[model samples]
Target: MRQTRRIAETPPPEECDPRVEALVNDLIGRVADKWTMIVLEVLAQRGELRFTQLFRLVRGVSQKMLTQTLRHMERDGMVTRTVHPVVPPRVEYRLTDLGASLGAAFCGVWIWAEDNLTRVEDARARFDDRQT
Candidate 1:
């Protein structure tokens, strides 16, 4: 059985290319990771942030992992990394229009979760009860 409703049973929806589908899957997988969402949230709230600032703001994430996430975001054209030539070399990151739009889109998910928290909790409780 299909989990998602299909608008039509025959012809598929528009923009169903395999390459696009694979890219969407890869990007979605990356965004669904714990650190990516938190970093996106922190950057969205705080605007531009330096390496140390991000490390501090996004607590519990190691420096190495943060570096990787930032790199991935940069490669995806979601974030822009600026390097400042200074005594210690300062690098700051800010979200591009794409990243900002993505953040805004995910904000809708947060709103939905907040709106349905009680219903979701009730469902979870009912599921747990059945397991026992």
Candidate 2:
């Protein structure tokens, strides 16, 4: 009997063609931040939110870190920021069309995780039982 390796459905393009390595690297580099997915999800769900709202929505994120993440996402053309001339100078952040597309991608992954979380927990419990 021979054992066969399970091939990944979406292997890195470079494995098939070297020409795609640069593109893969660029795409990975752009979204390499831990907070990027959360930010996208929040923006997707809320449409537009102020900095303070985001701080509350995403737990454990510092104000400075949130500001920096938003700035980077804005620079990457994934988010847009609007400033109001109000007394306190209100500023709001929202996903651009491009950002919304990325947000949808994140949402898809999030859904997959949520759907499989129970299975994952069960698997972990079984594994731990085996160790005991």
Candidate 3:
């Protein structure tokens, strides 16, 4: 019998449990939201922010959408929300270590986007010119 390298190198799927796979799927499902990215980034940068403060800071997000995004982040353990009793009631948000790490990772992508935006616009213009 001849043993091929591919056969020798192949790992059995049984090595991975289904529960672990489900957890990975759930994690990806959570992290894929752009709104979540924005919320996490804001919290990471500002340290702490009131709900209304965040709504204003992240231009173009509706109050409903921002609330939903914050709820999801809190559920995922990426953010911590505290409610304080005051004249009008105050809620504050901040990122967890995990969330900070996520923000740092995406900040690189955001910086890259900022630095290359002009080049990207040029490419789009050239592509449009070719199309027309």
Q: Report every candidate's CA lDDT.
A: 0.91, 0.82, 0.83
Model 1 misplaced regions, further than 4 Å? 1-11
What is the per-residue lDDT of model 1 for residues 29-132, given as tens digits with 9 covering 90 to 100?
Answer: 99998898898999999999999999999999999999999999999988999999998999999999999888887787899999999999999999999999
Error of 3 at 87 (Å): 4.6
- Candidate 2: C-alpha RMSD after superposition: 6.4
Query: Residue by residue across 52-124, what tens digits does model 2's lDDT show?
Result: 8998998889998898889888987889999999999899999999988876655656789899999999999
Which model, 1 or 2, shows the larger lDDT?
Answer: 1
* Clash pairs, model 1 backbone: none
TM-score of each: 0.86, 0.72, 0.71
Query: Candidate 3: where are CA atoms >4 Å away?
Result: 1-32
Query: For model 3, what is the error of residue 49's alpha carbon versus the real structure, in angstroms, after optimal superposition?
Result: 0.9
In the order shown, the candidates' Cα RMSDs to the true structure are: 4.7, 6.4, 7.1
Worst 10 residues of 3 by lDDT: 3-12
Candidate 3 lDDT by residue in tens digits, 1-132 = 965435368864667898888976776666677778778777777889999899998988999999888888888788999999897999999998878877776677789999999999999999999999
Task: Please give me the total number of clashing residue pairs in predicted model 2.
Answer: 0
